[model samples]
Target chain A: MKTQRSRGMTPAWAVAALAISAGMMVVTGCHKKTSTPPAAMAPTESAAAPTATISADPLSIDLGQAVVLNWRTTNASSVSIDGIGNVQVNGTQTVSPSSSTNFHLVAKGDGGTTDASVRVTVRVPVTPTAPSGEGDMGSDALFHSHVQDIFFDYDSYELRSDAQASVTAAAAYLNANPNIKVLIGGYCDDRGSAEFNITLGENRANAAKQALVAAGVPAGRIRVVSYGKERQFCTEETESCWQQNRRDQFSIDR
Target chain B: MKASRQGLVFTTFSTLLALSILPAAHGQDWNVLETGKSASASTRLAAADLKPTGGAADEAKHTFDATLYADLASAGLFDLVSKSQNPQATPGSQSEMNLGQWAAAPASAAYVAFGNFAAQNGKIVVNGFLDDAKNAQYPQIFTKLYNQDDSAEGARQAAHEFADDIILRLAGTAGIAETKIFYTKKDGLNKEIWMMDYDGANQHQLTHLGAISIGPRVSPDNSRIAFSTLDKNGFQIKVYSLLLGRIVAFSSVGGTNLSPAWAPSGQQLAFSSSRTGDPEIWVSDPAGSLAHRITSFAGPDVSPTWNPKTGAQIAWVSGRSGLPQIYIMDADGSGVIRLTDGGYASSPSWSPNGQFLAFAWDRKYGPGAPGGQDIYVMEIATKKWIQLTHDIGRCDFPSWSPDGRHVVFANDPDGRAEHTRVMSMLADGTQKRALTGAGADMPNWSWK
Candidate 1:
């Protein structure tokens, strides 16, 4: 029976492999070729050339530290840093050391040829560097602890800087969890008329979902619903109750 | 003399009752007194000259000319000639007749008045007319208003008294603008109390609580509205002043207070309370003081409506007979009498004329299968019951128009799953129409 079952699954596995190979090939075809500099102008990974440098580093970094990079070439035209890391390029065209650094830097010559390399180092600040809190709460506990809130700007769902921060954190957590699906429920305070608030609440949930997708979270994992001001946590006419009620809550289905 | 004035008051009150239940008519041409528009040719006539036929009718005509214009215009029937037609003229003064210009004016009909005012037996007498003739010397009709007693003091009553007479002569029915109906609407998450004209126009929500409100009743004089709303101590009875825009609440000492019914004189209100444990009928003065328990039934008793025709009688919903049923009793809660016997019936709304009672009755089966919740009106005199609605839905909250010809209510046969709408049907259960778009429920028809 086991042999027969394995035989039945073989064709499925073959089909999946074929599909994945085709996708990879398509992706490869879209890449543009970068011209290489003359051999004499080849800059070592640590050197900063007159041309721009390709910056790279570790994905995680500690706060407030220096990092170093090893490279061999100089006279770089321009150098630019990209992604979320702090680095300083020295006269030697190499990334300086820092308390915690992980980034990629590319050095280019005047002819447009580039030399790129990655450097990583720990830069711990006040708190100890720890892994993500996902594992500590167990899937179910973590789901409940994940505070999903969509802040508003004085009766508006327009995204603000602080709102982006909250959505970013939520997206990161969602990206780490594959098996969980979440429903984003939007709510509003009792300020304006009832009918207007219902539509406003809907817009808020949609905005949060949009933020998550931009942050690399899968679209299929998030569903949105608006309760308007229907289910207010408090019935008081005070501003405090209104603020608390005008938020979004994320619920996960196991 | 006092007795005659009381008679006039009764006549005026009865006219108000006449405006109670007007049916829904399509494309009604309401003749509003165009505030900033040109005056109707009839405005040139004196109250006495505007009257038609007898001198007795003329006196009444002069008494309620303003009320006649307001009621007929609001009913979407007669157009009121603007009172401000001649802006330079004083408020109480009349304009001089431009006979040729008046005749050429754009009115389908004209009213001209001329009369003598006299004091008789400590009462006042005024004659009126509705003269369509070119000269005021030859008037078309005449009406009279004679008050033999000086006990009554309000000008509103006298206005309606004369307006009623004019309405009968012109439209063959009583006018309704001077009357009013108390109702409730779902304002966002909370139910709001409101009152408006009889034609489903002039709507204004009265309450703005962060809590739920339900069931409102109007006083006979159309001055005060009584309703129930939830507060810190559960649901309580509240009386709202239509003129003052003020609200007075009556908290329950023992149980929840709800479903208030106004006495004919507008002096006291009867309501249902659970203060003694189970829902029972109780009477309290308009001030919410001097409470007296009326019913001693074992089950919940609610939905009280006063019978204006009867001296001191009321109709209410009682669950004493296993299911909700309609019952009638004396004003003081004595001499209990059963009205409806077949099935579940609640939300009793008595007609202004005291001829019929409209209520919500539950059918044996749910919607579509066969039976469902329906609106029904039963004749008080003959005990004849007529089912007003029959379909796959349920209808509740039946309120009568002052004319006793129509009933407005809310229908949600599908329960809370669908939108509830305000609907109206003829008193005989025909020509049902939905006024509100959708998702609206618990409508209270205004007598105004």
Candidate 2:
């Protein structure tokens, strides 16, 4: 509580700084952060409170198409959006949601908080275009695009024949692109405990990493992480959905 | 010294013989509190308002008086006789209490608490006495005097001390009057670590980690809180020192780390980390040095909770046998034993007395599930279990209170998705009460 930390940080450490800034605010004996106003959230509604509403003509739209979001606040001093930063209390903005996303409109006034949220579900595009950089990618790019995920059986993390084939192809791709470092993110279906899922997911990720290393891909080039059941690939209780969730998805590290 | 020792033994034997020959006092009306049967019929108590005696004693008297009554009622072991139900007696000392009258009639109170609180000359004095109305000859069972600062907080402290004394003598267990609870709350958007009283009062934010912080485990000494938060490293466990009120650096990095459990001695911390390949139980000091893997099983092992009574044993969840089950092992990872055999079980919390374990289990996990997850307590020696909650949507992360008489857990009472409220109940599944509104979860009771 006696000293304040310097908030300056490099780009690589920006997320860490902002995350730890919340803890630093407490350390400096202050509840308010100078960098950010207060954290934004869906404020609990109270009686006779500040009023806000976010409206849209169509709550659903085609992927990559724009939808106008109009907001109105009766007694708000300021308003902020999720992706689009702060805007006028009463204004309009065109948003092209790539996925099912919720736009939270938070209004701050003298009395208290006023918040309204609207979700827009993006319809699947009729014609699927090539993924980014796909049009001009060489074999390395093709390999990068072709790298597949390794799946696991229910409650099992051992690498199977099909998953081992995927890992073999992935290791070949990494061998061609020697400079590309990858991170393996493990995920699980929402079946058991959240805490247990962390370990199961990490073991899945490790199983993938071990396969790639056994196939001659440098172990140093791969890192492992577990999203557990937090970042699910599917939300249904069906076998197909659970199968899709239990896997190791690979990504190139920045 | 030897002659006095023989005389002391003779006096104790004589007193026990005399009490055994006495008739059953209060009959079946009092047997409910003495016998461990139908504990839902809690003990009846009447806390007479403290008589103010000196200058500036009104405010202190009010604070102490309300705090004592609230503590007694919240203990879940007593049916408090409200002020209106009292027999208009302000007995400040043992001589003033009329045992025969209180034992019968409208008051009908089996036990009575009478006290006097005075704040005079910048000092406060509290004199309290417990009277068992059935013991007519020796109605006075206990008395104590406390001297403290003449302040509001001091008054509350005196009440907590006095209530603990009464509970210890009557309930045969230590009271959680002074204990605190460490938990996580989803206030607005930020899920930060928070602390509150054992009775769910005086709640305030303890950590400002704006990221999603979960699984808060306070140290045995109440000096630090160990929880995991998602930062650039993705859910790295952080230790916040309560004394300095700041985050201290941890040596755990390079992978995901979470679910911290402190050994009762406060010397070692056991948590789950994937730093050495896969997530396994890792032990280290609070400063995060001397880290080593204690569980190197093929399957994943996580959520390690140490037996609070002894630092030599640990219990955790393991996915080794197809599905996750509760397992117990030595602190050094030897002498492993699987305590659970079927269904999905996690969040195994060892009771304070080391006689039982409380955990959340589905017991019916599959397609078309039969029942939702509920809290269950298992006896370590006999392997007997009794469900504490049933059909309550989903209840998880059950932690035992400091006295080991009750359990507090997070439940989606309304069956709403992802929303939960804090709840507590007796270990036998009686006297359930909601401790918090929506958006609070993962409650951990403090060590007394």
> Highest DockQ, which number?
2
Positional deviation of residue B84's Cα in model 2 after best superposition, in angstroms? 4.5
**Segments of candidate 1 deviating more than 4 angstroms:** A1-254, B1-166, B171-173, B365-369, B413-418, B430-435, B445-448
- Fnat for candidate 2 (0 to 1): 0.68
- Model 2 interface RMSD over true interface Cα atoms: 2.0
lDDT of 2 by residue, B1-448 (tens): 3222111100111010110111234231111111132231446778888877755447878888888998887776776787787877678788888877676767778899988878778778999999998888888879999887888777877888899999888877788888888888885656888888776767789888677788898888888989888665556789999999999978785778989899999999999988877678999998789998999877888899999888889999988787889999999999999987698899999988786788988877865667678887766664555567866678989988888777889887765425787888766566678877788888998887
Instruction: Name the runs in model 2 displaced over 4 angstroms.
Output: A1-144, A148-154, A158-172, A231-247, B1-35, B38-43, B51-67, B79-84, B89-96, B117-127, B136-138, B145-156, B187-190, B414-417
The digit string of per-residue lDDT tens for model 1 on B380-417 reads 65454556677737678888777665678877645442
Give residue B50's lDDT in candidate 1 (0 to 100): 37
Model 1 C-alpha lDDT per residue in residues A184-235, reported as the tens digit of each score: 7768775432222444555567678778889888877776655556567766
TM-score each candidate. Answer: 0.44, 0.69
After aligning candidate 2 to the native by TM-score, how far in Å is the CA of B430 from where it should be? 1.4
Against the true chain A, what TM-score does chain A of candidate 1 give? 0.44
